[model samples]
Target chain A: MHELSVAQGIVSAALSHIKGTGKVREVHVAIGELTLINAEQLAFAFEIASHGTPLEGAILETRVIEARLRCIRCGREGKSFTCEECGSAMEVLAGEELLLEKLKLVEGDGDAQGI
Target chain B: MHKVSEIEVQEDLLAANRELAQQNRKLLDESGVTAIEVSGAIGSGKTTLIELAAKELKDYRIAAIAGDVVASLDAGRFEKLGIPTVPLNTGKECHLDAHLVSHAIEKLPLNKLDIIFIENVGNLICPADFELGAHARVVVVSVTEGDDTIAKHPAVFRKAQLAVINKVDIASYVNANPGRMEEDARKINPFLEVIQVSAKTGHNLQRWFNFIVKAVEDRKQHGI
Candidate 1:
């Protein structure tokens, strides 16, 4: 349930990135497999936080990546789904990421604000 | 009229929490309080161990921060012991992060405390992922929880500096093999300090108490 804290981070990051912009259209996030963040909950939290801010009505899109593990014993780089070589427990090298990947800010008038 | 534009961005979502945790860690270091965090499943007697410590360290100015989902009852229990206890209700959250701990610390008279104990929510899985600025992380397990807890939650057990096997008095009635539990924990964490105690009856509680006192004293001596 650290998702609320995680969501607050997302909102802060998005607001910082979109400062000076007119409004925010959407927020893009990248979630890794091992982060334990629930996307739906995060989205809901974002919605609640974005209210009355420049980010109101913004959509939250999350891109989830599978966890990757590196085998220390065999020097094998593979997916953690299962270790093909050595069969030893795999050490996670990446994909535990909880990142605010992209932000889409809206500015300018409708006629000139071609996306 | 609405306009749409895209901005490429890359940021870390946990940056804020991590920063707060770092700040709390610094505060803990500066205040000279050796912060110890304990995590375990429900009914593992985490609070009982802390209560035992509080009783033995009556001369020291001690404080505790307890994290629970639905209750301030645990903190109330600690308050009755005459220790300053801060309750962090995580709502639906499963664990307390550095931010909550730091806030709770601010509410306590941190400068006067010799040691602070943080009892993480009753969980073995989620608490391992977050660091709450503790000098030591102790993982408690009762015999009834199962002998294989160490093996089942290797992540938690591996990260723990000390693994406590509580309720040793009931080990026989529950058919729990304490030796096997210790061995399995050792296999996961060879450097772990294993202490067996029955907090219900004060069985070997002195060992646990002495461990905390020594660890706190050593931290002060080593300037950690």
Candidate 2:
């Protein structure tokens, strides 16, 4: 799936942020519902892409955010695709995000036990 | 003792691709090549539309990059038309990213080309997520695919600058309503320019050609 590319992107971003720091322990990413990325597939892809890199054995955590749409006709905001009051088309206001939110790094001793 | 620290970093997942896309945009602009990304489902007549456009826009030098999962069948068609064609086998990739396109540009005779059309892998969902630094994005939907195809794939339509409803000649036989397809596309993207054409019978193909010529002219004038 395209999640492989997405996972590679996440690994790249995380590695860039944690450059010169200690080994990465966990990576937290936020994907919007509109992106249509499967969380399980992303984790698998991340594991594969991170192999032999500093991110090896790092835990991948994903958080899916709900889509938000704004009604064009009624000026109402909600998660639904259509306006509940006016029954008109709604514009997507959010939920297209695919961001590397945060990273957990272990400093000092590089003990791989209980990772 | 090992200490775990949480660092808050908000970075886009597609940042790397987007950065390369910017570079591509600059390259296309500097080379004065009007690039357009054409995306659609399999057998939706994407190659046919490009073929027709190449014939109609004979005054301009045209080159095309065809992307497919396995075969370069579409690229062969372009070669037959005498247009310089580059076929990219994406292997496991669903769509062609900017990185691949950047490499494709290096192989082409950019100095002689006026326009470069990128026919994305036959799919709607994945191609919409990628930006290949094209001046415009066109999505083709044929009548044989059903009128609801536009409504079914809103994400692609939303990003596309133009929507081509092809195969109007077979609309009656296939029971596909072209009007509904245009209306659905408008619902998704109100500003999206739409045209109905039949690449087979050359019906309304002139309009499509005119659109391309105008886009190229506008890009040249605005330097976009």
Candidate 3:
């Protein structure tokens, strides 16, 4: 699915963000529900996509974010786009993000200090 | 130093895509072109729908960008219809990302065209995560695929502005219900417009053509 391509993006982003030489240990990502990404599927994809990269054994740690919906007319809050109170469509305020949050790296032999 | 440590990055991975998509939208707006991205599974009549549009929408100058994993089969079909066509192949990627669409748009005479129909790499799941800088996104689900196609792939429906249940002529033989698909699509997104048609027989496709016309008109008026 799209998870494999996204996992490759995570590995590449991690590689570019790190300073100097280091073996990546873990890559943390925040996945939102509205993005429709399955965390377990992403983990499996990360394992495969990172196989030949610097993040060969790096763990893909994902955090899920819930979607926040709000209705405009009545200012009511609900999950689905259709509002229960007003019956009008709700707007999405949060969730829809796929961000690379953090990275854990093991310093290489040539590395002098931890980043 | 073999020490292990964590560093904060907080980088947005999808930012590049969103930015490029925005750029593409701006370019299309400047050129007065309305792009319609059609996504569906293989054999879902995506090409046929576009072919019909090319033949019928004579008032508008139409071009096409066909995305496939390999081969230019779809592009060839568009070319045969006397339409300018660009074939894009994403070697291993499952979806047509904004980066790829922008690359294809560069090769086209954007200012000379009134509409561009982008046929996404045939599939439901992967395309949902990717937006190809289209004013309207339509998902085509055929009767041969099954009634549960829309229910199983809600993400695509949620992202699309409209949904098309195609191959209605053969629905009885296949035991597929287009009404169920239409219902499922509307449940996911209230604003989404669902239409059923048979591209093969040219049945009820005028409504879909009307949708394209209205979408272009709306985009022109809304100034997005």
Candidate 4:
């Protein structure tokens, strides 16, 4: 499944992120409309794929972006599926991406002795 | 007071699948086997075309990977023809991705094969999005399905290296136009190699076979 591959990427990214930092608690991802990733399946796949990695217990946070298209015939700028003036098929200019937008890591130990 | 901290990381979600697809491509190239993947809606005669290839490729070692969402009937059909087949059951997934192929290779002896025909699940929209380690993706359409299917699903035709118009023997019985279909396919992808065939009567099957053999030889000569 594509979800398995996506999960593998997330696991590898999380492991690399933690390696760069000291620890990782959560990872946030922004998936655009065209990626067609099922969030629930991706989460399940991530949990299973991360079982042997350093990100075993890490959490996955996701944000979905709506698909946006631009009118080719007219210079109209709006969020409608088709242009109101010409009603032609719009080109997908944006919002069809699967990006690892953010990662939240622990910088230092909270149980430090210093005030 | 509690402190809140966040670390930023940017990554690509399709990185793993793309990497694996590249590896599969390298494997296919090195093995000298032209991996051809065919896609179309159900009952489009993809298996029949594959059967034609298997029958004609007498000198070469041919293997196949038939993918279906539920059953392995297509793969079973290939196996009946004495060709080694690896059945891929995708469960609920619509298309066969690269990782599934990478795993299917374990069951197939790539070193002994010259051609690997991957008959993708019978669907147009979902299969277009995946790269299943194929050297060429061929799309099969039938006269019974109407000529406007290419226009309705332009992405599938655009992604395919070849477009096959099958079931021409029944064209007169169904009022189908081959000329318009070819035009629509070319409009979607001008470079698409279009072939008309009928698996029932074996018309133009030799041309399809010639196309496959020539494609394999061409790829071999170019070292692709």
Candidate closest to the true structure, highest TM-score: 3
User: Would you list the C-alpha lDDT of every candidate in the order shown?
Assistant: 0.81, 0.88, 0.87, 0.79
lDDT of 4 by residue, B55-126 (tens): 888998999999999989998999998988999998877788889989887688888999999999998766
lDDT of 3 at B205: 95
User: In candidate 4, what are the lDDT values of residues A45-102, reduced to their tens digit?
Assistant: 8888878676666678888877676777786655544466776545666555677877
Candidate 2 docking quality: incorrect, acceptable, medium or high: medium
User: Which pairs in model 3 have colliding backbones?
Assistant: none
lDDT of 1 by residue, A8-73 (tens): 678878787775646677799999876667899989988887887777777899988787877667
Give the Cα-based TM-score of candidate 1 against the true structure.
Answer: 0.77
Instruction: Write one digit per residue (lDDT tens) for candidate 1, span B9-69.
Output: 8776555566777788788878888888989998899998998899888877888898898
- What CAPRI-style quality would you assign to candidate 3? medium
CAPRI accuracy category, model 1? acceptable
Off by over 4 Å in 4: A1-97, A103-115, B1-7, B172-175
| Model 3: CA > 4 A from native | A108-115, B1-4
- Positional deviation of B139 in candidate 2, in angstroms? 0.4
What TM-scores do the predictions have? Answer: 0.77, 0.87, 0.91, 0.72
On the 0 to 100 scale, the lDDT of residue B73 in model 3 is 93
Candidate 2 lDDT, tens digit per residue, B1-224? 77778889988766567789889989988999999899999999999899888988889999999999998999999999998999999999899999999999888998899999999999988887778898999999999998899999888887888999999999999999999999889877766899999998988888889889988998899884
